[model samples]
Target chain A: MALTDADLVARVLLDDDHHAFAELVRNHQSSVRGVLRQLTRTDVALADDLAQETFLRAYKNIRSFRGEARFSTWLYRIAYNAFRENARKRKELVGIDEEQLQAEQDTRTVDPALRHDLMHALSLLPLHERSAVLLCCQNGLSHDEAARVLDIPLGTVKTNVLRGREKLKRTLAAWGPN
Target chain B: MNEMTEEDVLDRQLLEAAPYIDDNGFAARVVSRLPAVQRQRRSMRGIILVGITALGSAIAYTLSGGGRFVNEGIVRLSNFPIWLLFVFAFGSGLVVGACAVIVAIRKTPEVRNLRRLQS
Candidate 1:
């Protein structure tokens, strides 16, 4: 029988079994990667580092997961926290140098040659709005699920989704208004 | 211009263009790293255990008779010599530390693929 996430978590917690911990990583890696890629503007290096950090953090804190929700939900929460912490650290490291940071952001702003201008526009959004769109629209997560993953209220999620859509519309409209 | 919103475009484009982002070998790599993490943890535990045992032995020897405990029907290690306790502690610490370092070296990600696999 396939081991449920709860069972794997239980095994790891009880015996510190890395195999069980690995199972958890295997289960949610791709979806985690997908959301992370969108959030970090396909900065694969940063996403990979954060993914590893996320799993490590989860391994350390598995005992605190009370199993009140699905394992993916709990894992998503960890990923979100990892992204938040990394972003905060990045802001601190960059100091008040908006020019350098904006240049970096511009570089990450999707290749113009790629025909997927919509996706490129989505990547340009503020982190919260982009995250809300990815989680709710692309990932098919409900408002409540997105809110839980983002540690925000459902109403905030709704507003972000609305604003994110509006911003993307404006961005794409400037691109020949297709 | 008609009312073709970006959301409408993205909704359709994502359905068609969001190539299933499955990073091949991700699980395998993660699982492969597990044994090393486990070994590191186990060796650290072993090192701690050995250190504690050696310390207890030395403390007990210092607090009581400084004699060597032999296996001649002895039930307690309290009679072990202070010199033996020192030797055992130092030797055990060396062995445990060596094992821990070896495990850590072996576990280092020499061939790890850490790039975000977003294909």
Candidate 2:
């Protein structure tokens, strides 16, 4: 049986167990990377770099995690902050260059059509809505948790998710079932 | 089958479109690149512990009239006979050396236990 995150965290805290931390990294890397990839507007290389930084920061500050949130939620908070900090350093979002994003996406051959539609629609979303949607829909974070991760109010999270979903529905309407 | 809400369907679609990235040695890369954070934390804890201990010792020493005791001992030592003073100095040296050795041995078990647990 897999160990609970608390169990693994206890091992790390009490014994400084690298193996336990590695287990955590492996478990959460996908979602953390995914959220970052979308946030970076499909900048795979930059997203991966930020994901690495997120894990590094997480390791360094693991003691400060108060456990009121789920482990993944805590990781998401770190990942989100890392992305925002990098974006600020790079001087704001500056909007997406969709053509470049498309070129990058083309290099991967997995479910191209659906992934393409999803990425494009996500790009069209307003920043707040996109973050809310990604955290709630794609990353499986609750609205309350998403609010915590994005540092937005819970009401704002709910509003963004509703608006984001409505926009996504219209943008991808051709692909939706009747 | 037809009862799914539009929001539910869209959420399902988004979830499906999101891919799970394979590790492909990502974990190893992260583990390799991690700083010596645990070691840094341990050393920091040790520093704080030492600082607190030194402060406590200073306060206790002052409260116990340690300086006066040392001064009185020195004055008394000067008054002792030469042979008795030599014996007193030798015994004091042995006692201090034994206390140092005992403190060193007491720290060894903590390290041994850590190694045993990790193994």
Candidate 3:
């Protein structure tokens, strides 16, 4: 049987086991990176860097993992903070370059026009709304879990998702359902 | 079309179409960047054990009349040249001054900022 997250955590805490930690990195890397890639507007390189920082921070603070929440949820919280901090720094610098954002969206979308429309609609949403929708809808987190990850109230998470969905629907109505 | 149902359909479609990137050694990359695991702090049990042993030793020494020996040794040392006392004081001051300088250098904002940028 595969080791539970708690089991791996115990190994890391008690024995300072790198191998166990490596297993954890392998297990959760995809979701963490996926969330970041979306959060960073498909800036894969920056997302990967933030993901690395998240894991490193998690390792440094592993002893503080008191099993209060699911390990993945805790990890998501760290990833969110890393993304927010990097976003703040980037905002302080030159702000996000429009061309760069378009280029990133271009690479990820399969149907250029439709994907571009959807991406544009998503980009129009406020950051918190975008994050709440992504976490709850795309990332398959419940509203409660999304709230925990975003460090916002449960009602706010629901409101963001509702408002975000409504906005996307209105924006995409011209395209209609394929 | 009912507004609520139309919006729900769009939400479902968007969720199902969410992009997922392949890992492709991402985990290995993160593991490579992790700093070495720091040494865990000493446990409370170990600290308590050491404290108990130290207290027990001190109590045993006191009960065994070891204080007389310490007093006699101090008396003999006191009889030595007064200049020797000054030398000892100066040496102690030098050691403390060096330690303070080292700590100050480590605590400087530049050093801390450099470390932060590196990490």
Candidate 4:
């Protein structure tokens, strides 16, 4: 059987095991990178850079992870902080060009244009709503987990997710039949 | 399947839009970027050694007459002439200062590495 995340976390803490840590990176890099990509307005390169920083920071601070939440949630918190830090350094987070995002998108997805539209709309969302939706909607984290990752209240996470979905609905409804 | 509701359709769309990203050498790149763990392990071993030595010393000190030795040592030190006391203080300060300098010199590389990583 594959080792559970808790098992992997234990291995990392007990031995500073890089193999275990690498497994963790492999296991969650998709979600971390995907969420970061959406967060960065589909800037895949910057997203990957932040994802790398996330894992490194997690490795340095793994001892503090009490296993109260899933390892992935803890990682989301780190990844989110790394993204926020980068944005803060930039003073303002600007949306990237759509052509770049459209070219980089996986052609395999059904309705690639709709997906592109969604990605663009998500990037245009208020940062809080974008993060909340990406975590709870895109990444499938529970509202409470999203709250923890966002360091926001449960009510606020729910609000952002609801508001974000509503905005998406209205946007899609207006743009229609793509 | 029954037609999906707006909420359900939106949720499905969100999932489809942000499907699992592939590794595509990302994991390898991240793993490669990690700082060498052996250095940290070595430092941890050093800390463990110092802890063990301190613990052993404490056990020995307690097993012996801790208070009596402390009082006697203080009295003996107090009995030294002022010039000798000044010399001892100066020598201790110099030793501490030299050790600090050595430590700072040794740490320069790690500091540089941290700055590089930040960039």
Candidate 5:
């Protein structure tokens, strides 16, 4: 059987063995980086810097891992907290304008028009709503799990998913459902 | 199968289109720095321990020879076994050494806890 995450993390912490950590990082890099990219949309360089910083912080703090949640969930919490700190430091509040949202919508060349509408709808959303939607829809997390990672209530997670979907439906209608 | 709603379709696209970035030896770099940091911490612990050892021996000798006060209790306690004292000193030194190394080698609070837990 493959080494469980807990076992691997224990090894990483006590032994300073990067073998297990490398496995974890390799497996989750895309998902973790996707979250960073979504949060820091305009700054690729800053996003990359923050992504590395998040892993470094997580490794540094891994010994405090009490196994209160799944390791992936704990890692997500770290990423979320790190992103929030960077946002606060940079004063980069997400006040997404419709025009800029439309421009972001138009920049994607590869996605279908419907996909673009959905992405546009997501861009237009308030930051927390967008995050909840992406974590639930894109990342395939349950509302409860997303709420745990976001440290919000389960009800709020459900509400955000519902409202986010409804907004996407309206946006797709405007784009005429290709 | 459940229907893929607009949100679902969009999310699928997002994941498919997402870019991957590597951390580039971040873990190795951090680990590399640990030993030197640990060594520095170990020596500091050693100094404190040495000081404590020297102080304890001086106090024992001072009391044994002729302390300023002729307290009877002081006289008896000072008559501790030389063998026992040697053992105690050795044990204390070992403890001080372990503590010194532990303090020096640990990188984070979590790592420190990990060491204690592992032990």
Candidate 6:
């Protein structure tokens, strides 16, 4: 069997093994990048940059990782913070404009127009609701885990996911067949 | 087969759609940015060893009558003036208090998290 995350963490911590850390980055990069993409409203380049920052921060603070949570959970927390910080900076520079927000949400390059509509509906969600829904639905994190990643209460996470799903359903209802 | 509801169809479509961007060298870019891990570990080990050695020397000095020698030296400086001694004691206390506050701040979770991000 492949080494567990705990084993990889031990190698990185005890042996300062770069290969172990590389394996970690390889394993989790997709999920981390995906979450950031969603959180950043599909700003792929910015998402990738934040993902890189997240991994570097993880490596620097490897010693501080107390292992109380799963390694992935801790990494997600860091990614969430990185995304928030980057978003804050961007907001300060140029407040989120509707046209730019719509552009950022347009990820489907060749898909049908319905896909674009779906993405637009998703983009209409409040940030917390969007993050909560994406973390729980697309990213496959449990509600509790999503709560931890978003640094929100469990009830708030539940409320966001429920409200987000309802909004998506309502917004897409126009396209629904009679 | 059961008839699919509209919500079910939409949910399936959303779930099946690829949500993540394809990793075209993203991992390599991140790995390249990482610091030299072995070198960092070596330097950290050296610092830790030096710290332990310094702490041990200080303890040994205190146990080996260095404490008394320092006390005697301070006593000899008593010839300066009573007010001078009080000012010296207050200055030393302020320095010690500041060092303690710095160490405590470094140990706080928020500071540690900020340091990790900044690093």
Query: Using Cα atoms with residue i matched to residue i, what is each candidate's TM-score against the true structure?
Result: 0.58, 0.68, 0.63, 0.67, 0.63, 0.64
lDDT ranking, best first = 2, 4, 3, 6, 1, 5
What tens-digit string does per-residue lDDT give for candidate 5 at B3-41?
A: 456556656765554445565764454344333334456
Report the lDDT tens digits of candidate 3 across residue range A1-178.
8987877877776667888898998888878887787677668889889999999999988866667667888899999999988888778324345465455445543344665567656765567777887777766788998899899999999998998887677656634566
lDDT per prediction?
0.70, 0.82, 0.76, 0.80, 0.69, 0.75
Candidate 2 vs candidate 6: which has greater DockQ? 2
Model 1 misplacement above 4 A: A92-115, A173-178, B1-17, B28-119
Q: Write the residue-wise lDDT of candidate 2 on B1-119 in tens digits.
A: 54348788878879988989998888889999877646787789999999999999899789868768778878988998999988988999999999998987675443334333333
Clash pairs for candidate 4: none
CAPRI docking class of candidate 3 = incorrect
Which residue segments of model 5 deviate by more than 4 Å? A1-3, A16-24, A97-124, A169-177, B1-47, B66-119
On lDDT, the stronger of 1 and 5 is 1
- Order the candidates by DockQ, highest first — what do you get? 2, 4, 5, 3, 6, 1
Highest lDDT scorer: 2
- Accuracy of chain B in candidate 6 (TM-score): 0.37
Count of steric clashes across candidates, in order:
1, 0, 0, 0, 2, 0
- Can you give the lDDT of residue B51 in candidate 4? 100
lDDT of 4 by residue, B5-116 (tens): 8778888888898867889888788778777776677889999999999999998789777757888888999989999999999999999999998898665443333333
C-alpha displacement of B36 in model 4, angstroms?
2.4
TM-score of 2: 0.68
Candidate closest to the true structure, highest TM-score? 2
lDDT of 1 at A118: 60
- For model 2, what is the error of residue B56's alpha carbon versus the real structure, in angstroms, after optimal superposition? 10
State the lDDT of candidate 4 residue by residue for A63-100, as single tens digits: 67766677789999999999989998987555434454
**Quality of model 4 by C-alpha lDDT:** 0.80
**Residue A11's C-alpha lDDT in candidate 4?**
70
Return the interface RMSD of the candidates, in order shown, one decimal each.
10.3, 6.7, 10.1, 8.9, 5.9, 7.0
Q: Chain A alone, model 3, TM-score?
A: 0.80
User: Which of the two, 1 or 2, has more DockQ?
Assistant: 2
Q: Could you tell which candidate, 1 or 3, scores higher by TM-score?
A: 3
Q: Which ten residues in a row have the lowest lDDT in candidate 1 chain B?
A: B110-119
